[model samples]
Target chain A: MWLRSHRPAAALMKKSEGTRRDFLRACIAGAAVLGTGGSMELLEAAEQSSALVKSRVVIARDPMLRGAGTTVDSKRALNLLDHAMQALFDADHPADPWKNLVRPGDRVGLKVNALGGHAFSSNLQLVEAVCERLQEAGVKANDIVVWDRDTEELERAGFHISSAPNHVQCFGTDRTGYEEDLVTYGSVGSRLSKILTRSCNVLINMPLLKDHDGAGVSMALKNMYGVIHNPNKYHPNGCNPYIADVNMLPDIRTKMRLTICDATTAMYEGGPAYKPQYSWKNNALMVSRDPVALDYVGWQAIERKRAEKKLKTLEAEKRAPLYIATAADAQHRLGTNDPRRIAVIEAQAGR
Target chain B: MAREMISLADVKFPDVSPINEIARGAELGPRLLPLDRRSFLKCAVMAGAVCGISAFAEPCAALLPWAGGPTQGDSQFTAEARFYEKLQNKKIKCKLCPRECVVGDRERGYCGVRENRGGTYYTLVHSRVCAAHIDPIEKKPLFHYLPGTLAFSLATAGCNVNCKFCQNWDISQVRPEQIRADYAPPKTVAELAKQNRCPTIAYTYSEPVIFSEYLMDTADAGHEAGVRSVVVSNGYMQTESLKAAYGKMDAVKIDLKAFSESYYRDVVGGELKPVLDSLVTLRKLGKWTEIVYLVVPTLNDSDSEFRGLVRWIKTNLGVDVPVHFTQFHPQYLLKNLPLTPVPTLERAKAMADAEGLHYVYIGNVPGHPAQNTYCPKCRHLLVERVGLTTGQILIRKGSCPFCKQPIPGIWHA
Candidate 1:
C-alpha cells in the first residue's frame, strides 16, 4: 500500500462521510500500526460533525501565498492554513483539529525546519497561525514553544527568538542543549534535543517540502532529524533506516500529533538548501497526521516536478527517499507510505 | 617564505554556519582558505583565532580574546580532497580510506571532514588546524628522528576510525566545525615551523590520514623551505592514498591499536587489515616509521595479543622497526576500564625484546628505564628522554658512540 495518489476528494466523501466516531476509530487503528499512543479525545466543534476522514491529508493551496520575490502574503497564508485545518477534521471551524489533538495543559512544540534559511524554510505566518489556533484551543500561549536546531538558524529563517513568559515561546536546542543520555534505536544512537525531551510533551512537525540531494525529499519524517543531536552521522546510505529508526524513539513516535509541510517553494534538484535556479513556487501547505504519508506525497510531488523538467527520477539518480517505505515497514510501522491507505482533503483557499 | 593572507571580500562566508555553510557554499568552491597571510593575519588576531604557536611565534599569534570565535565556523578554509571518485548524479566515493564511503551530495564521509557537492569532493579541514603545539620529536615518539629538535605539531578535527580508548578524542572524533580552527595553509604551516625553530612539521593530534591533502601540501611547502614533515597516524588508509600522502613524510609514527580483527571490530570502528597494509606500504616506500601500541586493560592487553603483535611485526615489518608499548590511561568510551599497569607495558616491551626487536620503548609512563634508547648489541643507552624533554643524545653520525653500531634514526638535524 505505497501509492499516495490524489484520491482525497473521492476518498474523503466515501470514507469520512460517516460519523465523527469513525474518524477516531480509524486514527486509533492507524496509531496502533505506527506505535503512536495518545488520548484522541473529541473536541466540542468536532463532536457535532457528521463527517470525518481517517488519515486525511488536507492540502491547502493559494496563488496569493507568495507575492513577488521571496516576500510572502502572511495574512493569506494564515487563511489557507485555517481552511486546511477546518477541512482536516471535516468540521466547520478552523480550531477543531487543534482542539481535538491537544490538551489545555500540554506544552506544544512547533518543530520548524529552519535549515533552508529565509528562502525556503517554514513560513513564520503559518507557524503563528498554528500558535494562535493552539491558544484558541485552550493551550497556554506560554506553553507553545517554537524551535529548531539553533537560535542563529531560527533567526536566519526569519523567526525571532522569544522566551517571554506571557508570549508564545521560541528558541533552539542550542539554548538548552541536548539530553546527556543517548537514545539508541537500530543503528541510530544519539542524544535527543532538550526542546523535544524537557521543554515540551506535544510536538507539531512543521517542515518544508523540498528536494534533498541525499534523502531524495526533505519533508515530514526527515524533519525529525532536528530533534536529534547527530543528524549528520545518519545521512549515509540515503538515510533510509536511520530516519525510520529516529521516529521510533518514544517521545517522537507517541508525542507528535501532526505534520504541516510548507510546499510554497520547493526544489526539484540540488537542494536540502535553497538553489534559487532549481527552485519553483508551488504555494501549498500539506497537513497530515501521518508523517510517512505526507513524506510520500512530497516525494511524488518532487518526482513529478523533476519529470516535467525532464530530469532523472530520484531512483535513477540513486538518491530515492526509501526512508518513507522503511518507516512503514514492519519494524518501524511509523505511518503508511501507501496512498491506498491515505485520503487527501484538498482546501483551495484562492484569493 | 612569507605566508600571505586575504580579506573577507576574497572568500565566501555564509550567515548560517557549521553544517549548512559548508554544504551550501560547496558550489561556490571547495571551502579552501590558507592561514592568515600578512594582510589577513592582523584581522585574524582581531577575530580571536587562538595563536596556534605556544612557542617562538606566540608573540606573533597575539593570543587575542575571542569574540565567541568564527560566529560558529570558518566560512571557507579548506581544500579539495585528493582521493575521491565522483559518482553519478552528484554522489562521491571517498578513496582516502578502506571505508570507501559512497557519499551523496551535500553529505560528508564517515570522517565528517570531507564533503561531496554536486559531483565534487572536498576536504573541509584542509588548512583548518584546530590543535597546534611545539613538541620534541620524542613527543611524537619518533626517537629515531631529530631526537632533541622540535616538530611543529598541528591537527584538524575528524578521524576515520573510532578508537574506544582514544586520548585525543575531543579533536579526533568531532567535525571540524565543532571546534575552533585557524586557517593555516601549506606555506603558512612551513613558515610557522621555521619561525618556531622547528625542523619538522608533525601532522598529529587528530588522525592525519583524514587530512591527507593538508599533510601532502604542507609537506611540499615544508620541503620548499628546508623544513621536514612527519605524521602521527592510525595508518587506517588505502595503500594508494597512504603512498600518495605519506610518501612526502620524512618520518611516520603509527598507532597499531590491537593485533586481532575482533578487537578492531569491537573496540575500533575499523579493520586491522587496512592499517597493517598501510604499515607495509609505508615500509616499502622507505619512510622512517615507528609503531606505538597503547595497551588498554581488559581489552587489548592480553599476553597472547602482545606475543602475536611482536611476532607479526618481526615477520612482516621486521624487528628493526622501533616499537613503543605505551601505557594507556582510561579515556573516551573506555573510561570505565582501569589504566594499563606499568608492569604490563614492561611485559610487552620484554616480549618485543625477546622477539629480537632492535629498539623497544615504554611510553606515557615518564622516567621509566625503557624510555632510554639502548644499543641492541652493547645495551648502552644511546638516547635518554624524559617525556617531551630530551636528556642525552649519545648517537654520533646516526651511530651509537659507545657500541659504534649504526642506530636506525635521523640522529642529526
Candidate 2:
C-alpha cells in the first residue's frame, strides 16, 4: 500500500525492467530493516508493500539558470520549477500538482532558507514561482507567507517585505516571534516560531542545498532548525538526534507537506556560509514530498561534487549527516533515506 | 479546512529594535550618546527603584520582550575581549572558560556572545544589561553576606555550560542580539546601587563568567563607590580568569550542579574539575564563597554523591564555607522529572552537616526551620529567614548573642 502507483509507465514496463525494479525494491527493504534496528514490523508498518515504497524526487535542471551576472534567470527558473512539479506528481498539466498540494482555503507557509546569504540562498525566483502557482490554484495571495529566521536576512537575500493585506505576505519569525509554550521532544526543547504554530496550517520547506560544517548538509531537515528559538544549543555531536528530534515535533511533522530545495547554486565545501570560492552552479531544483529522501539525494549530490573537486566526502571529513538515517528509524519514521526506495526523476527543463 | 486568513498587519509584532538602541551609552565601547547627568539619574532611578525580582513574578510575560528582536549589526561597537590568544588563519582560542572554544573568523564561541571577527576577538554582551532588578542578597542565596540588604542585580545573556535543568534557559540559552537590553555602564551601575541604598551590585541570573570583563569593571566601579560586588555563577572558568575576576568580586555563590564528572559532562555539558578549581581559587583569593547544589530526585540526590560533595568542601574549601542544598523543580529539557522531595533536600542538608560542613542550609522550602542560620556552638537560631526575606538577626558584632561564638560572614551589627 505504501507503493502507490503514480503513472501508467509502470503498467507498460518490460520484463527486464520489472526484474530490476524488484531487485531495487528488495535492496530498499533490506536497508530499511538494517536502518531501523532490524525492526521488520516497523518497516512493514511504515512501508507495507513488498515492492519498493517509491518516493519520487524530481531534479529539474536548466542550463540558462546562471545568467551573465550572479542573478538567476527568473523565467527559466520558473519554467524549470513547473516542469519539476509536473514530473513529481505525474500530472498532465503543471497546475494540477499545485492544486493537489494546496487547497483553495489552505493557509500556506513557504519556509525559505536565507542563512547562506546572497551567494548561496534560496532563489527568490523559485519562491515567486511557488507563490504564483499557489495563487493560480485559488489560494489567496495574503495566505501565502514566505519567511526565514529574520527579515534582515530575507532582505539581504533579495526578498521584499510585503506585510500588506492584498499581497503575498513576506516576513520572518522576527515579526511573529515564538510561541510562549515550549515544545519538548526527545533531546530538543524549544519555543516554535509563531509563524508555524499560529498562522499557517500547511508548510512547504524551501532549503538551499549546501555543505554544513557540523550537520554535514544543510537541506530540508536542517531547514526546520530555523523555526525554533534556540538552534545553537542543538549543534553539538554533529546535530544528529537533535535534527531528527526537532523534525519530529508534532506541529512540524504534521503540517510539513513538501520540500523544494533550491539547488541552482550550492556549496560543496565551507558552508552553510556563502563562500564564493567553494560555490558551484548545479542549476537544478529538487522536488519531493519525502523530506528525508530529498535530503539523502541532496547529500549524494554534494558528495558527488566534492568527489569531482578532489575533496574528501562528508564521512571522510568526519561530519556525516547521520540525522537522515535517524529520521527513518522506528521511533521517528519521518521518511525513508534509502536510495533504492527513492526514484529520482532527472529531466532537463524546457525540453 | 476553512481557515480564516489573517492579515500580517493584523498580527501584533514584537518590538524589533536593535539592542544597540537600548545599550547606547555603556562606557566599555563606543558610545551612541555622551553620558548626560539627567539621563543617568533617570535611568538609575528606573533601573534601581522601580525594578525588582517581583517585576518578573510572571516569568512568561516578562520574557516576551526578549522573545524576538532585530538582527545584530556588525557595526555595533565590539569590545576587545580578554583571555583569548590569536592563532593562525584568523582564528582565536577563547580561554575565558573551560570550554576553550577555538573560534574561526566570523564565528562565535560556545557562549555565543564572544565572537572572532577578522582575527580579533570581541564580546558582544560587554555592557548590554538584558535583565536587571533589585533583589536581596539572600535571593542570590548569599545568606552570610550582608543579610537582608538589597543588591542591584543584573545579567547579560549567555552561559558557558548548557544545563538541561536550567531554570533561566530563556536568557541563558539565547544570543545577546535575540533579546532586548539596556546599556548601564559600570559607573552607572555603581551610582545606581549607591542612590538606591543598595550595599552591593550583583552579577547574577545568568552565568556572570561569560561577561567577566563587564563584571570586573562593574566590581571596580562599585568598590570605588563604596559598594561591593557579588557574583552568582556556575563557576566554570579558567583558573587564571577565576583568580583575576574573583579578586575584584566581594562575594560569590557557585551553583555546584553535581559531584560526579559524568553528571557534569552528560547533564551540564561542562567539567567538574574547573568548577572545583574555581572554588579553590576563590578561597585562595580570600573571596567570600557559598555553594548551592540543586538536588534533583534520583539524578544527583544520592547519598554517596552528597557525601563526596561535602567531603570535598570540608577538605579543600573548609567546613566554614556555607553550602545550600536546594530543591530542584523540573525545567528546560528535564520537564518530565518530578520536583525534588522536601525529604531529599533535608536528607542532603543532614548528610552535609553530618560530614562536618558548618552553615549548611536547605533552599526553596520556605517556612522550614533549616532556612534559619543556627549557631553551631550554642544551637540557637542566630538569623531567622523565610525564603529570600531575612527576618530577625540575633547577631551582634559578628557573634551569636547567646553563645558569643563568631559567625563566619560579612555581619553588620
Candidate 3:
C-alpha cells in the first residue's frame, strides 16, 4: 500500500496499456477544439470559471526538435515553449501568459538546472526562449537573470555569464553569494541565495527532468536545492520532509510563479548525473503553476520511460520520490500531487 | 529609454574574496620580526625547540612568515587522496574515516571536501587553510604537555562528523569552496610555526580527521623543521588511516562526545564504537593522549555513564591518563538547550575520580580549583591553571616534585 501510494498513476496506466493512449487522444482532441478561432476566448472563460480547481499542467512535445549532437533546434524548442505557456495560462497569445506571470517592473529570475551537465541539463535554447518571452512580455532585459548554484557548472552546460546592468544578466549565486542570516524552517537551517532573496521578485523554476539517486527524481521541487547554502545536509531519509519543508519557505513559496521543466532528454535511471546509457529522447516542454503537480508529472514520465526500458520502478528499487506526496500534505499544502486533481493538457507543437 | 550594449567578451566575473580575509584582518596583530637568526633563536627557545633548528642554520629568505591574509580563488591545489578504493561505475569509497563514503563522480563525501572525480578521490582542502591562530597549548587543554606554550593552530573547511552543538560550525559544516582559505603548504605551515614561536602545530577548530592528509604532511614537515604536531579531533576515523596520521603526531586530544550510541547517532551523526576503538588504539600505540568529555546537561551527564566511561578508560588506557570534564555551552543547532552548569561538570569529574581515574579535572569555568593538576601519590598540587593561563608548575623532570613519582605526560625538563 505504501508502494502503491508512491507509484504514479501513469506507471499504473502502463499496465492497462490503452488507458494512457486514450487519455492522450482525448486531450489532443480537446486542444484541437480549443485551437479553433474564438475558442481561445471560451477556454480563458472556462479557466476563470474553474478557479476553484487550481492544479493544471501542460506537456507540449515536438518530435522533430531533437537535434543531433548536443545542440537543439532553437526554433522548434521556442515554438514548443510557446505552446506550453499558452496552454498553462489558457491564453490566446504566448506573451499574455508571460505578462500574467511576471509584471514589467518585476525582477525575474530563471533558476536553471545545470548540475546534470550538458547532456541532461536544462537546454540553453530553452532558457533563451524563456528569456525572449519575458522581454516580449514587457519585462526589461536588464531585470531578467538566469542563474544556478555556480558559474562553472553553468559554463560547462553552455551558458555565458553576463551580469552587466544594462543587459540580460546571467551568472550564479557564487557571484552574489548567500545571505549571512540563517533561515530556520523545520529541520532545515540554511542561508538562502542572495539572487533568490534580493535580486529577484519573481522566480521561474526551470528544472531538468532526471532520475535522482536519493530523491528518485530531480524535478521542480528538488531544483530549489540550488538556492540554499547547504543541500548536503538534507539527503538523509530519502530527502523527504526536507524537500517539502524547503518548498514551504516564504521566499520560495511566494516568489515561484511557474515551473517549465526541460524534458527534451531525460535520464530514466542512474541520474542527476549524465550517463549516456540511461538517457532517452523525450522531446517535450512541461509547464505548470504548481511545482508539486509538475514534479508529479515528471516523475510519471520518468517511470514510464523506466518501464519501457524493462527496468525496475523507483518504488520497486525502494527509492520512490516521496517528497511529492509530502509537498501536497496538509501541513505544507504547496500543491496537489494527485493525478485525479491535475488536468494535464498534452499537445504537439507546430501541428 | 535607450540601453547601453555590452559584448560578451567585456563581461567579467565579479571579484570573489575569501571570508577568512575579513575575519583574519580583525584578529591578527602587527607583523613580527623577520626570519633572521636572532628571531629564529629567540623563537626556538620560546617554542622549546631542542632539535632540528640546527639543520636550518641558514634562514631562507624565500620562506617568509604567514602574511596573515586569505588566498584568492578556489583553484589553488588538488591532491589525489591516499585512503580510497575505486569501485564500479566511476565511484570511489573513501577509506579515510569511519563514514566510508561511497562517492559518485563529481560528488563529494559527507565531509563536503574529498570528492570523487572520474573514479579518483581528491581532497579539496589540501593545503587550503581557512582559520589560523596562535593559541595557548592550555587552550588545546593539554595541561601536561608543554604547559603555557603557544601552538600555531590552523584548520581547513570541512569536518567528518555533524555535531549539533559544533562551536566551529561555520567552517566545519561547509565545503572548501563555500569558504575562503589560504594556500599554506606543509612547508609553509612548519616555517610559520617556527617563526611564530609556537612549539606545536595544532590541527584544530575543525575536525583534523577529514583533513588528515594535510595534517600528516604538515606533521612530517614540522618534524623536519623541529616543530611538533598535535591534533584536537572528534576521533571518528578508520583504524588504518588514524594509525597512519596520528602515528606521526606528538599528542592528540579527543572529544569523547558521550557514552551512548544513540546519542552519537541522533545528536552527532556518528558511531560511538569507532571512537571508543580509536581511544583504545591510541593507548596501545603509546601516544600522549588526553580526553575531554563536555558534560552537556541532561544529554550525557548521568552518573552511570560517567562511571562507565571512567571505568573503561582506567581499564583500557590506565589510571594515569588525564580526563577533562569540560562544560558545554549551547551553540549552533542545539541552542534551545541551556548552558551546561558548572556544578554538573564538578559532579562528573568527582564520579570519574571516584571510579579510579587518577587525573580528572573540570574545565570552562574559570578559577575553579579542579583546573589544577595534583599528584595521585602525595595528593599535592603539581600544576596550577586558571582559564588558559598556566601558573606555578611544580613538576620537575617529568615527576611530581613532592612525591618523586613519574607522571604519564610529555613534559619539558
TM-score of chain B of each: 0.84, 0.83, 0.84
lDDT of 3 by residue, A114-178 (tens): 88666667899999999999999888998999999998898888888898888889888888888
Candidate 2 residue lDDT tens string, B30-137: 311243554445334323321222431223223233224442453442589988999975778998998778776666777888888778999888768776665667
Q: Which structure is stronger by lDDT: 1 or 3?
A: 3
TM-score of each: 0.69, 0.83, 0.83
Q: Give the CA lDDT, 0 to 100, for residue B320 in model 3.
A: 86
Better of 1 and 3 by TM-score: 3
Candidate 3's chain A scores what TM-score?
Answer: 0.84
The worst-scoring run of ten residues by lDDT in candidate 3 chain B lies at B1-10
| Top candidate, metric DockQ | 3
Measured with C-alpha atoms, the lDDT of residue A340 in candidate 3 is 73
Candidate 3 wrong stretches, greater than 4 Å: A1-54, A67-70, B1-75
Worst lDDT run of 10 residues, candidate 2 chain A, spans A1-10
Better of 1 and 2 by lDDT: 2
Query: All candidates: CA RMSD in angstroms?
Result: 11.8, 10.2, 11.4
lDDT (10s digit) by residue, model 1, range B315-406: 99887899988766655566578757778888998888988999899876644667788999898987866444566788898887887888
Over A260-288, each residue of candidate 1 has an lDDT whose tens digit, in order, gives 88887878887776778788988889988
Q: For residue A85, what is the lDDT in candidate 1?
A: 76
